[model samples]
Target: MARTAVPPKKTIVKKMNYLTGFLLGFGLLLSGCNKDDDGVTKPDGPDPNAANLDVQDFMYKAMNLWYFWQGEVDILADDAFATDAEYTDFLEANPNPETFYFDVLLFSDDRFSFLSEDYKELTQNLSGISQNNGMEFGLVAFSNSDDIFGYVRYIIPNSDASTKNIERGDIFIGVDGVTLTRNNYTELLFGDNATYTLTMANITDGQISANGEEVTLTKEEGFQENPVFITKTFDVSGTKIGYLMYNGFTNEFDEQLNEAFGQLKADGATELVIDFRYNGGGSVNSSRLLSSMIYGTNTNELYIRQRWNDKIQAAFSPSDLEDYFAATTGSGTPINTLNLSRVYVLTTSSTASASELVINGLDPYINVIQVGTTTRGKNEFSLTMVDDPNRQGAPYIYTPSRENNINPDNSWAIQPLVGRNENSVGFSDYTGGFAPEIELQEDLENLGVLGELDEPLLARAIQEITGAGAKFDFTVEMPAEAFTSSKMFSPLKDNMVLDKDFYLPEIQ
Candidate 1:
């Protein structure tokens, strides 16, 4: 059948005036009833054949309602099925919710949509709480060979790695004495092993070889990271340039981030350089808040416009589409904005999603001098969709407050690409990622202190700000290209999340 899916303006029959119903309003009545004609329950409704297909219902419905490429996926199309039975059958066919989410429901173009088995875990991850080893590192393959090696990007303070001999610029050629390759790096370094030994590598006269030293690290739950890594002001040709090596846009650290800005402001920083080299991404609101801290807190100035799927868009009012520059931190602390015209951003392959959002969202308002490499090219924002127990089989955007309301039957939550975010000028096309105006890459040979003026990326930004170039060699030996990082493993950190208070069209 030809699927000409057109969005209905008023489709939801709200059971009650509640956020639960409002969030679950878009999808069709999701209660699975096998009997075709009347209100009678069919004996076949509890088909043993449909066993383990429980959460796929939630997954399919959520994707159908909110997925950015919903129209492109044939099964998710509004008219794809003739009856409720057909849709139920499809959900049953794919018993595994993860398989259904990854294989059947997702668009081929989607690169970042992910699912967590438990909404609790997912929420924790988005909040920057997780099982961590305290080591923030990047994994890359040798330029001339298939041998994979891990490098310490930075160590999270009070963590196991910080207590160990490992420090930034250190490389590990193996984990637990096993030589790392492209295939086994994930298993060796990131696997379930609570503790593992990292065999260090030595750079002797331009060649890297395995050294005898090994560092053992352990993973701990609820390990939270402060995204505001290091804040320092530099004297660049008498111009006070504020340097903020921000790692993630974690909302939990919003107030701390604001305070960091306050410090920069107090330091008489006329110029700003934000190092986003190792950052992947995080909360969109946090990105907005951070943008507000850098730019002015002009509440009237639009920060970002959320571009939802047509189904959602058709129901939204004009005002519901845009999010403005935040005036206060999430905790009601007044933002200490720099109000600077020009800002330098240090970016790399790891700088993605919400990290990219800050650059794109602020472009029409300021001069963003991008240093280092191109970004990871994710312009889409995702909503964490989980089953709402109050409304059976209905998916609601997961919020920390409504954790108890999540379906006890289904722990599954999908972080699906529900929208593409645009700036005030309606520019969202950074799928190929924003290229650097000043092309530079971090030298593996000379990985300097992050907050210090010696870091290659920071030095270059200072050069641009001061016009008196920092005395640093631009040459790189064994230029590393990261395949993945510790941040990449934390999908929630990389996600541009839209959580509670997000604009949902009023269900009339």
Candidate 2:
């Protein structure tokens, strides 16, 4: 049989109402069963042995109805590939149909939307669960050559790396006796291995020399990450500056965030420095709660405005657009709202999504001095869809009723781009990422320490705080070879999530 596929042309369904049938994350019922010759009810569930065409059909229908940029996509008209045959044909004809289908519908050049067959794994990933050796390293080239070097960025507490005494700033020149060159770094260092040897190196007088030590690390399974990487306070010139090395916005660590802030509050710290250099982003609600902790006065003010596609927008009232976090967390306890007039955020190209949201969202109310490099520039968010019978606990309320067509085997769920987030005073135009007010690169040649006042990034922020100015030159020469492969590390999953906020329905 010819597989279902995307039709070559647009095919708008005149009878279809996206608002009533599929406004939120409801399954589409495009092709229902008809009455049999004997007038008996026929089974409408998709065949378990069939070509699996329903999955592709569901993708098209959901994106067409609720995708944030549905109108801008020319080929994604309503019911463009609504049938099983068309979707199946399209799939069979294209080797990478999933990528091709999703890519054509994205009008904003979004790269975050994805499909996962196992939502249980996705849930675990979102909760900061992963299997790995726990070695976060950054690669650098030696004076414009392919000879790359790596330095341990940080160690997860109690992980294999930490247990093995693989401290931050420990340099490695080779992997398993093989030098990490630009040509083979990705393959040699990032490939899956149960155990490997790290050939250590050292930096002295602006040169990298081998330390002649081979440290073997065995990979472990189910290592949960703690987002509160490091927290410390520094006293500089009679000024108390609190520094935090926050890695991601995982909600499981909300109490940890509070504890860190509580210490800062008790220590009489007047200045704050948040290092988001390695943070890609995670929960949106966590971002909001963090913002609330920073400046508590904006309880009634708009934190962000969610704008949906036209059809979905029509379903919401005007008041539904303005959203704000409470002065407290979901636990009903008051947060440590600092009421600070200024905040310093240390960022890099990896800083993105919810991280940028906090920066952009807090800009109108306080001084957000961005230090380091530009962010990853993602303002979109997504919600995870599960194959649940009750449809409870979804990001949005799934009110549409489905009659007897439940498929227990629907293990697949998609995290599609659902909406764009803009802050109060209506400013979210950082498509190319927010440029740093004071630019400085990580001094790998002299990586002083992780959370100390001497850490290059933290030192710069302190200099700015102490009125010395954000003027710091790179100790290493210009345009060094910089490579990143931490994303390839095991157990570090889904750092690019902004998953909590959704364009909600009125619930009438």
Candidate 3:
């Protein structure tokens, strides 16, 4: 399941109502959401004074109010700025909002928080829609130099890369015939160009060199990737093992995910394996539902606990502080549950955010046999917010009920680390990422086909399952370090996000 919120520090929060009394009177505190015509609750634009406020003003106010580490950041103190002028001056100190956001507002410990130039793009990204060639690959640096080569992880079906000659396990050392180096790779490969060529490479004797091959790939506009990448059932000595190579916890594809689970259940699959080796993360709601499908749909059990900031968490009851196992999809469709007690999770450095959530949240309930390498160590989740005038887009879930109410003044959006997610037993400390029980890393030279049972990670999992197979050598010929993956280029990078619009509970 997608994770959200860390356990709050030891601080006594008084019993307060939905914090309509937020002490900061900078006029940036939410006065609560507004209802539009037909009496539907919608986002309110910023406060009256926010009309003239710049983007930095928006960033500072949002960080001060909702940043998970607000209590620790001295600059974010409620009384740090005694006068409104000082607050405004602090915002004005950095004219560039992005600069100010990175260098100042964000907590140093936070690694996954993000800011975007356009909320529309950010919203589409969180939903798994983006402009892309759809070749999901990971970059690895050469052992000697800053030069990096990319190994194809997987190809998105119906994508430009899918039609091209490039496939999983292929290696590329350059873009448009230019040898890729650390400094110019971003500009050459991920620039605004709609199309580019990948210069193929091969590794031999621990030496990576160009193979004199090139493939041109084009970025498709509005490419929508389904998170349910590969789903199949493996018959292992009369025991049915269902395998799902899920890529993200995207909420828009929840129906598809449910259907995949339904297929596994239909196949009489008793054992389950979820391959998240390359999955970064997405919607927490989807993660919760996905977990419920694997585990039982027991609404009584807590799936995840959220520890909000002291300013607002006091308003929540114990029940409100937690997200329980869902009985059905948020759309009310009955979930197709495998109800498996033990699950095998395939992970890598790229398996992160919600992927880690599934591992951590289910740890207290089920046997999660994590294979492959450790994860990307993100225990926090981000809230999708736009520059709404209403408390500067006070984080509400990016749901249909409310209009995003984006301040027409700007197109910027911010996904701040607002909560720390813990499982039922209060285990939220995987910031260094979850270590694998079956410590294995992908063999770059022999990156096998994804689902055909011969893929190294999956094969190793099968070995652990059937118990009749001989051991295979886990060796790597490439001498390099994994830098990043193709998902890093996506607008929503390593995010396990809260999609439900959260306006503070009806102000008492």
| Global lDDT scores for all candidate models | 0.75, 0.65, 0.74
Model 1: clashing residue pairs?
none
Tell me the TM-score of each prediction against the true structure: 0.86, 0.79, 0.85
Q: For candidate 3, write residues 392-465 as lDDT tens digits.
A: 32443233334546567767777777777888988888777787888778888888899988888898888887
Candidate 1 vs candidate 2: the lDDT winner is 1
Order the candidate numbers by lDDT, best to worst.
1, 3, 2
Q: Which candidate gets the maximum TM-score versus the true structure?
A: 1
Residues 35-123, model 2: lDDT tens digits? 33444232333444556555554555556556777887875654344444554565445344356545554554555566667545654
Candidate 2 residue-pair clash tally = 13
Measured over all alpha carbons after superposition, the RMSD of each candidate to the real structure, in angstroms, is 7.5, 9.0, 7.4
lDDT of 1 by residue, 332-372 (tens): 89999999887899999888788888998888899888998
RMSD of 3: 7.4
